[model samples]
Target: MRLHEYQAKSVFADAGIPTPDATLASSVDEVVEAAEDIGYPVAVKAQVHVGGRGKAGGIKLAESRDEAEQVADEILGMDLKGYHVDRVLVEEAVDFVNELYVGVTMDRGEGKPVAMVSTKGGVDIESVAEETPDAIAREHIDPAFGMHPYQARKVVYDAGVPRELARDVASVLQTMYQLWDDRDASEVEINPLMVTDDDEIIAADAVMNIDDDALFRQQELAEMEEETFEDDLERKASEYGFDYVRLSGNVGIIGNGAGLVMTTLDLVDYYGGEPANFLDIGGGAKAERVANALDMVFSDENVDAVVFNIFGGITRGDEVAKGINSALEQFDEIPKPVVVRLAGTNAEEGREILNDELVTVEETLEDAVQRTVEYSEEEAQ
Candidate 1:
C-alpha cells in the first residue's frame, strides 16, 4: 500500500502542509502541458514505487517546456529497478537555502510511533547514519497521547535547525504525525524539507505507506489502487487470495502464517540460500489456498527450489498436501524441485500421501532447508 510521490504530496497538501505545486502526467504531451501550466524550471520525477530514482536518473530537471517534453520522452518508458516508469510528476522547482529530513514511522520494538529528524537532507538517510550516526535524531511518541507540540518542538530543536524555522518545522512534523495516525499509515516521510531564502518552510518530497490491514476503514484510499505496473503473476496471486511479495533470490518459500514464512526465509538464508519470494497462505490453509500459493511460487522463473514449511495448528496438514497435488495437476510443468516439511496435526498422514509424489519430504525444519539449499546448488551447477 505504498503511495506514489504525487499521491503522497496530495495527502500532505490536504493536511495543510506546504508543498510544491505538481501535476501528474502520463505522456510527453501531458508533461509539456503541465510544465507550461506550472511555468518552467520544473522537476520531472518518475512516479515509481521503489527508491533510488535520483541515482537511476529517473529525476530530471527541465528548464523549459521543450526540455520537459524531451526528458519526459526519455523517462516515461525507461525502466527503474525492473519497474517501468509510466508516469511522471511535473512539479514547480523551488530555490532553497537549507534542507532537512522529517519522518514518522512505526517502531515495532517500542510498539509506538517514532519521529525521525535530521538537519542533513537531500541524501540517503542511511548514508548519513553510517557516516555520522549522531546527525539523525529520533523521538518515540506515545500512541495514547499522540505527538504533542512540545515534543515535536524538542525534536526539531535537537536536530540543530535554525531557531527561526524550528517552530515551522515542528508544526509540519505535528501535521505529518496527525496525517499518519489518522490515515492508519505505516510511514509518512518528508525528505529534503526545504527552507527558501525568505525563511519559508516547505515539503519538497513526500512518501507514504499505509497499513494494508486498515484499508477496510479507508475505502477512499483503497479505491486509489493502481495496477498499471504490477506483473501478471502478482495480479494473479492477488486474485487467488494469497499474500505474496516477489524477491530476488532463488529459493521460493511458502508457509501457513507470516511468522512461519519469515522464519522459513531466515532458515533458508542460514542454510546458505536466498529466498526468491515470501508467500503466506494464512492460518486457514484450505486446498484451494495451498494450490494458489504453490501456483504463485512456481510462477516465478527465478525460483530454483521450493520450500513448504507448515506447522499445522489451525490449518490441517492433509489439506495442504491435497493443495500441493492439485497445483501439480493444474500446472503442466513446475519450474523447480519442491521440499515439504509437515508437522503437528495429521502430519504423518500428509507425509504418507506425499511420499509417492515428486517432492522431497524431511522430518525436521533444518533438514528440509538444508536439502532445499543443496538441491538449489546442485541445480545451479
Candidate 2:
C-alpha cells in the first residue's frame, strides 16, 4: 500500500529519522494556524497519493500567514492526478545548500533489498537512471546480515557526497534501511534529502509503500492504511475479509482464487472486454462475504456488468449462489446484468437456487465471458 507524504514522514520520524517540522491541516484556518505556529516561510503541500504535486501547483511557498491561508484554500479540494486533496501538510521552509536522493527498495531480480543514492534530487529518479546512469550508486543489502555502516557510507561517497556530510547522509541511509526492514516496506524513499547551511541533514520529501502481505505483522501500518484509501469502494473492500484491485474496464470480475481471477482478466481482454476490477473472495465464502464482494464491485461507476466465476473446491457453489441471491434481493433495483459460472461442489444445486431473470447462468467459462461481454456491450448501447 502507498502512503501520503505526511504519513510517510510520520513513519520516518518514528524511526528516528529527522524531518522538517510539519503540521497537518484540513482547512484554511488550520493552515494559517500551523504556519503561524511554525513561523513564517512554510510550505503548503497537498497530501495526495500521486507525485508531481509541485508541478501541478499542489505545492506552494507561503512567507506569511495570509499567503499560507490562500495557498491552503487553493490546494485543499483541488484535484491532483484525479485524487481530491482533503488535507495539506504545512511544513517549515528551510534553506538548504545541498540536496540528495536516497532510497531502499526491493530488487525483484536479486530477491533482496538494495540501497540507492544520487546527488540529483527533487526530480524523477527514473529519469536520472535513463539519462545518466553513472550518477547513481546502488548497493545490494542481504536480509540475513542487514545493511552495514561501511556499506552505507560507500554508496553515498560513490555518489559524491561531500566528506563533511557523508557520515550524516550515511546515518540517514542506515536509518532508512532499518525502517524498511522493520516495517516490512516494499520501498522507502527520501527525495531531495537536504542539508541546511548549518550542515544539518533532514528528509524534505518522503515516499513509502508497504508490502500488503506483511500487513498482518505490521498492525499499526495496517491501521494507517485507511488514510490512503479514500474511495468508498476500496475502504469497504478492506473492511471485508477479501482482496480487491481496481482496474479500468466495464466488466467487474469476482472469482474464488487469485489465479482464476487473473486468468479471467486475460480472457476478458481476449474476448474484447475490459475488467473493471479483480476481486478474490477466497475459499469457503459465505452469503454475507459474497454479498459484500458484489456490493463493493457494484460501487464502481465504471462497471457495466459483473462476472462471477467460481470453481468450488473448498468453496461450495451453493454458498456462492445464496450470497448472490441475497445481494440482488437486498437492492430494490440493479441496473447492470450479472453473469455467473459455477463448477465443483453442488454446482447443480447452486444453479437451481439462482434461477432468476436478472442473472445469466453459464455452464462454462467461455460462455460466461462471452455473455458478460455481450451484456456490457448491451449496457453501453
Candidate 3:
C-alpha cells in the first residue's frame, strides 16, 4: 500500500514524470558504484516507509566516492522511524534555484480528490500549513471529469509559482493526477519538486500509496510491492482469506463482519483487556470457515483467550457453533479459553449445540468480553 522512495520514483518515471537520475543499492559497494556512475555530488538517501528520513540522518550528501561509501555505510541497516533501511537511492544532486511541493490525495471531507501545490518545498508540508496556511493552495477535482488543465494552472498560480514555471508545474500536477487515476492510487506526491535555473523541473523526492483494495486490478503496480512481509501471521492471513490484523493483546477476537469485529476489539479494550488480533470471518461463513478462523487465532502465542461475537445476519449462528465445536475437536487439548456470544438467527439452537464443557457461552456481548478478559488476566497471573 505504501512504497519506499525508490519504488515510488520508479512509478513516477513510468508515468513520464521527470526525476533525478538515481540507482538503487543494497550495499556500500553498490552505493559507491551508483555514485560513480551518476557522477559526483549525489544524494544518498535511505529507502524507508515513514517520513522524516532527513531528520533521522537517513539522508546525506556525497560529493566524492569516499563520502559516498561513508554515507552508505552509516545509512544502510540504520533504523528510520522503526523501519530498517536495507536499500539506499544514490541520486544526482540537482542544481536548483527553487523548490515546490505538488501532491494529489483524497480530501475525505469534500469526498473528492484534492490536488495541492505549495511554494514551500523540501520541508514538512504540515509545518508550513500550521505556520502559513496561505502558502499552500488546493483545488478539488471531480473524479468524473478528472483534473482540468486550467484548474491545475490556477492552483499553481495561486501557490505563487513564478509565471515562467507555472505551465511546467501545472503539467507535472496533471501528470500526477493522471498517474493517481490510472494506477488506482490513494495518494501521489512530489516533495521538493526542484526547479533548475535552466528552466527544468525534476522530482527530487517521491511518495505514492496505492489503495489496498484496488491492488486486484493494478497487477503491475501490485507486483512492485515489497516481496517480504514483516509479519508472518499477516502473510498467512492473506493466504487464508481472513480479514485479519495482529495485535499485542492477550484476548483474541473473532466476529462475522468488520464492524462487529472492531466493536469487539473496542469492548475488549474497554473491559481492561488487550486484544491479541482482529479476525473477521465475514458474512455467511460456514462451519469450515469458522474452524479455520479458530485455528488461526489459536496459532498465535500471544493469545491467552478467544472470544467469538456472532450477530448472525447472512452468517448462520448454527454454522458458526458447529465450526467452533469441530475446530476444538482438532486440538488434543484446547490451546486457550474460548468464550462465545451468539445472537440473531438460530442463536439459541447454536448455543445449545455448542460443547458447554469446551467453551463458555454468554448471553450478552459485555458478559462474553468480561469473561474472556478474566480468562486472559488469569493467564497473565
Candidate 4:
C-alpha cells in the first residue's frame, strides 16, 4: 500500500501542503518534455517502491533536457532493491538554505500516532536516530484527540527552525496529519522540508503508506495499486486466498495464525536460517487452504526447506496433514525438504499420517526449526 513519490506529493498538494512542481515520465521523450517544461537543473528520481535509490544510482541531477533524457533512459529500466523502475519524477530544483524532517506514523507499542521532527533531514531517519538520537524529537498524538495546532507548533519551534517558517511548518504538519488520519495512513513523511532562500518552505520529497486493512474505505487508493513488480509467489498466494509476504530466507513457513506465522519466521531466523515467506492459512486450515499454502511455498526456487508449525486449536491437524498429502500427490514433485510440528488437538494421528513421507516430524517447535535450518544448510553446501 505504499504510494509512489508522485502519488504522495499529489495527496500532499491536495491537503494544502506546499510541494515542488514535478512531472512523472515513463520514457526518454517524456522525461525530456518534462524537463524542458520545468526548465534546467531538474532532479530526476526513479519511481520505485524500495529505498536507497540515491545510493543505487536511481537519483540524478540533470542540468539540461538532454541530460534528463539520458538519465531517465538509464534509470527507467534499472532495478532498485529488486523493484524495476518504470518511471521517473522530474522536479524543478530549488535553492534551499536548510533542510528538516517531519513525519507522522503509527506507534503500535504506544497505540498512538507519533509525530517525529528533526532539523537534520534529506537522509535516512533511522541512521540519524541510531547515531544522534537527541537530534530527533518525537511526540505521541492520541488517536481520539488528534494532532492539535499547538502540538505541531511546539515541534516546529523545538526543531530550531526560524520563526518565519514555524507557522508554515505547523500548517504543513496539520494538513499532513489530516491526510494521515482521514485516509487511514500507516505513514506520512516529508523528508527535506526545505527552507528556501526566499524564506519559503516546501516539501522536497513525500511518502505515504496506507493501511492495507483500511483499503476497503479507500476505493480510489485501492484502484491506484500497480502490481507490475509484485513477487510471483505473493501474487499466487493471494489468488489462493492466503496472506503471504515473501522474505529472503531458505526456510518456508506455513501456519494457521498470523502470530504463529511470525513466531515461526523468528524461530527460523533464530536457528540461523532465513524465512522464505510469512504464509498464514488463517484459522480455518481446510484441505484447499493448506494445499494452496504448500503449493505457494514449494513454487519458490529459493526455498531450501519448508516448515509447518500447525497448532490446530480450531483447525484439525489431521485435515492439514491430508492437505499436505494431497498436494504431494497433485504436484509432480515437492521442490524442497519439509519439517512438520503438528501439535494440539488430533496431533498424534497427524504425526502418524506424515511418518510414511520423506518429511521430518519433530516433537517441539525448537527441534523443527533446528532441523529445517540444518537440512537447508547441508543442501546448500
Q: Please tell me which predicted candidate would have the highest TM-score against the true structure.
A: 1
lDDT of the candidates, in the order given: 0.87, 0.90, 0.90, 0.85
Number of colliding residue pairs in each model: 0, 0, 0, 1
Superposing all C-alpha atoms, what RMSD in Å does each candidate have to the true structure?
A: 3.6, 5.3, 6.3, 3.7
* Worst window of 10 by summed lDDT in candidate 2: 226-235
* Better-scoring candidate (TM-score), 1 or 3: 1
In the predicted model 4, the residue pairs found to clash are: 249-274
* Candidate 1 lDDT by residue in tens digits, 258-354: 9999999999999899988888888868888888788778767778899999998998888888888777776566568899999988888888777
Candidate 4 deviant stretches above 4 angstroms? 94-98, 130-132, 160-164, 197-199, 226-231, 246-252, 266-276, 286-288, 298-306, 322-338, 355-360, 370-381
Ranking by lDDT: 3, 2, 1, 4
1-381 in candidate 2: lDDT tens per residue? Answer: 888899999989988889999999999999999999999899999987766789999999999877887899899999665467898999999789988999999999999899999999878998999999998999999999999999999999999999999999999999999999999999999998988898998899999999989999999989887767455566677789778877767999999999999999999999999998899999999989998998888878788999999998999999999999999988778768999999999898899999577599999999999999999999978
Ranking 3 against 4 by lDDT, winner: 3
Worst 10 residues of 4 by lDDT: 226-235
Q: Is candidate 1 or candidate 2 better by TM-score?
A: 1
For candidate 2, the lDDT comes to 0.90
Candidate 2, superposed: residue stretches over 4 Å from native: 1-4, 14-18, 48-64, 74-86, 94-101, 118-137, 153-169, 192-202, 209-231, 245-252, 262-278, 302-307, 325-343, 346-381
lDDT of 1 at 156: 91
TM-score list, all predictions: 0.82, 0.70, 0.66, 0.81
**On a 0 to 100 scale, what is the lDDT of residue 102 in model 4?**
94
